[model samples]
Target chain A: MITPGAALSKSAPLLACIGLLCAWQVASLALQTESFPTALEAIRAVPSILGDKESLVNIGASIRRMAIGLSLAVLFAIPLGLLMGRIKGVASFFNPLLMIIYPVPKAALMPIIMLWMGVGDMSKTLVIFLGVSLPIIYHSFQGGKAVEEKMLWSGAAMGLSAPQRMLRIVLPAALPEILTGCRTGLVLALITMVTSEMIARQSGAGNILFNALDMAQYDTVFAMIIIIGAMGILFDAAFEKLRGWLVRWSKPQHDMPLSFS
Target chain B: MKVVSLRSDVQAEPAALPGVAPAMAMIHIDHVSQRFQTSGRQSHLALSDINLTIEDGAFVSILGPSGCGKSTLLYIVGGFVQPSDGAAKVKGKVITGPGPDRGPVFQEFALFPWKNVLGNVMYGLRQQGVKKTDAEAKSRKLLEMVGLKGYENFYPKELSGGMKQRVAIARTLAYNPAVLLMDEPFGALDAHTRTRLQNDLLTIWERDRKTVLFVTHSVEEAVFLSDKVVVMTRSPGSIKVVVDIDLPRPRKRAELLLDPRYQKYVVDIEKLIDDTGEDEIHA
Candidate 1:
């Protein structure tokens, strides 16, 4: 159904991305340096990277750590944030603690976390959890707090109990903000995961890249970097799609543009 | 100044038909007063010693100037606000909090943005333990009653102000509340739409008579929609007069415009507001 003009506009971003890749390839060729692999060299290195069993192990481990850490953080943070936002007593107790902890650079806690838990998956996961949970909690709190007063009154007048109103009205109204929080938290989780991996015993993509760079395996380093970048793009796209599906009801009110990342 | 007695003229005729018993009082506001703390060490009273009785099946409007506590009075009756003194009783039982037995329609058209017309209407029914299928059926019927038959699937944001208010009315009625408390339900609409909704509200009210306590700033709207209009003074509002509209049933806007009795009632209510000399009441 798309006309030529419509198709051109739809494909414009993809075409621009292709153009940028071609320019990178040309620059790599002109430089003729071993450290900076050309796009072709990096793409060719993918087979050997896949052939190496350690690559799969590292990718699997990283994915598992991300899943575990992010899951635990979301499970605890969302409810705590909602409670703090909706209940005066809960907010009074948690507000000071949240304010103090939220601004502290979470990445700076990695050493302390490692000292407490040792250089194990627990430390890495804790680091990721710490980095990710604060943003989600803060955003969810704001989301829950910002539900319109008249909306609450309507819920009350409809004879809904407090719990029912919280579940059916407040939570749904806060979904868009919570989803935004989750998106931001996902990026933080990945960053903390890589940092923890690089600092700890070598298993994830972060360790693989460092190992390749130390050994002067320029092609492998470039390949690992490209793979991590692709993973980040993929996760961002997936979350954006999830957001669209979850919050289609609020599309009219949410004026924010759809972001690529 | 002494509060004028406008009800005397209508009550003198004793207009109840022969075979019908007198209507029972549904909502009783007994010496209610509300005070709000504006800032540190200062408080403003909204309603002062307000007393009124809404008979069962009667459509009554509380007409006043803006910030005159008419809405506060409605909120107290609906159990959303507690009076600093006295209380509001529904069917002789003191209201402690909001319940399914009384529904409120707000001027802001408080339809849930996430819920479409059908879902919004079914919300109260669902809360009251009705099954999903039954709630849907009841919601469909109510939407039809409010002239939103085809818009059941449309979200509140997609609807015009009038249509949204229609959906809000349908949502409130779906729960089958014994009394409907409306606070300027048509206040946000255009003049044309407001007139149309007033007529539609009358039609709907006639079919199923629930005791209604409507609050508004419009003199004409109050006269057009109610069996009685209670006028209140500005700031720390108290009832100035209760004017009875004894116009015949099934009244049309055009026909009522020409009726001398309707004109007399409108002017009398307007004069009540004018006598206060604060602000002119809107149409």
Candidate 2:
């Protein structure tokens, strides 16, 4: 049923991606600098870099940390946000504290965290957790607070108890917004994990990049960068798939090219 | 256009209707007044001394100008709002809060966006602890009654305005409430859809004869679908007139349009609202 134009539109993103890689390859070859590796060189380097056990261990460690940190942040922040959003007493008690701490740069807190917890996995994971939790809490709070008044009245009229209303009506209504928050938290968790790894010289993807740069393994560095970028894209795509499956009732917008019957 | 005085005879004994059984008050609103605090000190009175009685199995429409507290009065009867003075009672019991006994269909068609059509219709029954098999059977029947037989799997967002309201009506009826309170259920629909729904509603009303208190601004709609139309004054609303619509049952829109009696009823209610000197907005 899809038209030619629809097929073309779907391939547009892939075309743009190929175009960007071609431009990067051209620029890198023209410059011929040791610091910059051509796209071909970086692509050639990926197989060797991945095959190496040290680099593989680093990549695995980074992903594992990000997963744990992100999972914990989502688990803790969602409940806290829902409670604060639904109950006036909880909101009043926590609002001032959240406002004050939410904006302080997580990177700036690393030194203090290191001083308290020492330069280890504990401090790095804690930094990532702190960075990720703030946005999740804020967005989930907005989502929980935004349940329509009319919907609440309708639920009440249907003889639903307050708890039943919250579970069946309010929670589902807020889910899309909460998922958006989780996606944002995922990106933040990845960034904070790398930054913490680099600062602490820990065993992770960032540590591999630092070591390769020190040894002048330019191709290896570029290959690691591409791997990290691919991971980010993969995580985002996974979240989008989850959103599509869970919030199936919220239809996606139809902006595709016109198709004849 | 002609004006008739049906108000004088009907106001004397509110329950005295021909062909209906000995009267039993299903909903009794006695001097119900609602005042809302606008700001720190200012208060806006919505309804004032609105006393009315809706007999069991009667279809009554409350007609008024927009923002004249017609919805507030309906909400009070539905127990969604508490009156500042007096009380609204259903079957001799004071209504403190919303219950399944008085089902309400809102103007926005407040359907759950997450649930599909069948799920929304089954929601009340599920909450009331009905078995899944029975609830599904009853819900499917109600959906069929509302002309939404094959649309059971569709979400509220996928439905048209008329369809969404149809789902809301089906959902309300599935719960089997004693008194149905609809606040301008067809207000957002187009004229064609509105008339079709009006006819459909009348058909449904004729079958079950559940007591209905419908609120709307359309004088023609009130005359066509209601047994009695209670017109209210502007702002701090009170009962202005009650026009008893004695039009024969199973009325047809095309035939009723040419009927002189139907025309007179519409004209009378229109004149009563016009006499209030309020500019016509959305009712």
Candidate 3:
């Protein structure tokens, strides 16, 4: 059973969110600008935004793109990471390439991708893929490389074959690091998904936000910002739950004792 | 000139005789020496001119002060390290690398943390391609033998220090190695746990009769577990004495503690160890 404090902690973020919304409402009212909608106006627009089929369709499209790109990134990253991790020569050969390419903004490649793929869904998907793949690959590689020598020796001494050792011992030991990488990659994928839509596509959450901004629908723009924030939080929560399940064995046994005054 | 040459050849014959019948030696440490070379420094000698024989099915303990290469010698026997000068052989076969034939129990109870107690015991058998049903049956039997029957499904983290060592021993013995190398396997346990494990180890060794080469700093432990305790001198270590343990089998802990002979062996070894003053040299 989860502790009472943990349950309370989960909702603390929502409370802070509400407090921010109230503060924004007060400030917007004081400013009295049409460009900055009050919190009440944004809240009133939420139902309309939910009722709008186009906005829902755009959200769906963005999620679909993210799912496809992230799936492809994981598929490619796992094997590449394992290879680079297991073989020193391969790691050395690819190290410079990854280091050179990983840091350059994936958005910077959108124009080139557009030129190649004609500004279609393909180009946006490619941008998200590029942004997500590197971190995943790098983290998995580091994780696999970090397997302790003694653990490997233990496997070897037990007469485990190379393949068995890698699969049973090395992979599980490296899993925590891989999950961390996945978490980071997932956040990057979300950011890049929005950026790709804003720059290249015309049918996603980014497009809706852009349209709302153009029409000076400040309340709708505020609604879009809230949706984006919710999406980020939702994805993070899901990834964390999966990670916790996968690495339950890796956690330390002792929990800190409660102190009462 | 012919008479003088004949006399010299006859005198040199004894030296060559030792090399001719090397196979008869169960474990041959043939002038073996190990050196470690670090960057920008002279090579350090860990072991030097160490020559000894361990008879078949003999229980031997290598007792020495810290940095005396006691553990290094055990590693060499286990085929985990190579000798810089000569060679170590088991039953006339040269020690090249680690194999299932030689099982080693580490001090840290290096059972894989992910596996349950039974799984860890069965690991060696599984690796050797034993069928699951048979391996499981065998593992269960071994676990029962180690007094860990009910706790088979528990992971290493859940077990006590003594229990973990039992699992480690069971894992090593699952391979049915001809020789067992234990490097201070009870060093980390509490006094009570250490004594309990020592007794358990003796029980297991009595039943199996496998050649055991145990390394430890404790003189009493060396005397208690060994058929012969080979006392070693410190730094660039060499065998100083081999004291025979004449105590009978199925010896209880209390009896050994009270026995005058056991006490003498412990005191003698401790005195010899203290006389070396080699601990300061290593420091």
Candidate 4:
């Protein structure tokens, strides 16, 4: 049943990864810069980074914090966003504040947050939480707002109470949009995790990248970049798979696929 | 044209079927009016002092032109929207909000997009605390009744316009509502599909004469499907006339299309609607 287009599209992500590496290989070879290593050297260095116990544990800790931050953000934002969408007063109440906060780079707040709560995992996690919350909330609001009134009426006619209608109808109806929000929030969580770590100079994948740069270990630096990129790709692809399954009934909302492989 | 009239003025109030005791009014929309707040402080009058009594087990169509508040009146009866001035009562009790007593089938179909045909049909039954196994069995039967037996797992987005409406009808019927409020349920379908659904609806209706309050702009649809057609005028919409459809049951489209009585009713209702169009222009 697989169409030719789908088959080609299936391999597209793998093809993209190889193409990027090949391009990087050519560019580094052409430049012949001591600081910039070839793609093969970086790929070779990847085993060393993964084999080191400390680096592995550091990466693990970073991921753990990310999971906590993202989970907390999702818990806080979805209900608030749904309320904002359904009630005009709630939307107006929060709109101005969200607007003021929206444009401020959340990673930039690491320093300020550190001043208040120090540079523990707490401050870094808070930054990730802030980075991830906005998109999910915005999307959930749009999703909840877009729910058809007639659908709620149908639920009501079936003897569903108001809260029952909101829970059973609005939540499921808004799920596709909410998941789209979570997808964006996922990538943002990674970027925020790395950026906040780089800013705070804490122990994580970002710290490894910074430390490699300090000692001029260009291979380690590029290898860490590849590891981070791989994590981003892997997380996004996995999330996309889960999202598709959860909202199988929904029409394809976006054109871009996150590369299944 | 009614501010308040004897219930019979709207239609035969008692609706005494021959050789049967007369049934009580299924719905009493007493002087209901609706005003929508537009931009600025301006308010637009939608329904104007609407008063009508729909008899029990009667198939009544609220036929009108676009923007005539025909659908709004149906919504009022379903208790989705409260009237700005008056109230709508069903079975001698005021309709404060939507309940299982009155189920609505909207033109949009309003099926839960997330639920498959089976889940959509079973929603009401599940909500009513029906056991899982019993609800599943009943939903399958209803799906088969709606000609969607094999499409139990198919989502609403996967179905065509007519099929979706069929599923919607089955979903509302799942809870066994005493009154069915259909707001132009067939308006979105093609001529062929609409015709087929009309016949199918009537066949279903014949089984257990649920009091139906249907709304449609098509005179043909209204006349073909209802026991009475309540013609309405727009822009502060109100009833213009009530035409009793005395056509016999088990109406065959092929034969009814050629029947003089059926053709005459369609033509007369079309004229009535046209007159309202003229009145709208004059106003």
Cα error, residue A126 of model 4, in Å, equals 0.6
Best by DockQ: 4
The residue-by-residue lDDT of candidate 1 on A159-259, one tens digit each, is 77888888888888888888888988887888888888888855887888888889999989988878887787788788888888888778544544545
Cα-based lDDT for every prediction: 0.84, 0.86, 0.81, 0.89
The positional error of residue A205 in candidate 4, measured at the CA in angstroms, is 0.8
TM-score (0 to 1) of chain B for each candidate: 0.93, 0.94, 0.88, 0.93
| Lowest-sum lDDT 10-residue window in model 3 chain A | A252-261
lDDT of 3 by residue, B85-203 (tens): 77778887788777787788888877777788888888889889899999999999999998999999898888888998999999989978888889899988998888888898899
Pairs in steric clash, model 2:
none
Per-residue CA lDDT of model 3 for A1-261, tens digit only, reads: 989999887777677778998899899999999989998888788778779998898889999999889989988886688668988998999899999997799999999889998777798888888899998899889988988755666677777667877888777778887877788888889999999988875889988888889899989998888888778878887877787777765745243132010
Candidate 3: list runs displaced more than 4 Å: A1-11, A43-54, A76-95, A253-261, B1-26, B280-283
Q: What is the lDDT of residue B30 in candidate 4?
A: 81
What C-alpha lDDT, on a 0 to 100 scale, does residue B58 get in candidate 1?
85
| lDDT tens digits, residue span B1-283, model 4 | 2233334444455335565467788898888889999999999999997888888899999888788899999998999988887778888788888999999999999999999999999999999999999999998998898899899999999999999999999999999999999998888889899988999999999888999999988878888888889989988898898888988877788888999999999988888878765443211
The 10-residue segment with the lowest total lDDT in model 4 chain B:
B1-10
DockQ of each: 0.61, 0.64, 0.44, 0.90
User: What are the candidates' C-alpha RMSDs?
Assistant: 4.0, 5.4, 6.5, 2.9
TM-score of each: 0.92, 0.91, 0.84, 0.95
Candidate number 3, chain A TM-score = 0.88
TM-score (0 to 1) for chain B of model 3: 0.88
Per-residue alpha-carbon lDDT of candidate 4 for residues A93-194, written as tens digits (9 for 90 to 100): 999999999999998788889999987799989999999999999999999999999999999999899889888999999999998899999999999999
lDDT of 3 at A201: 53
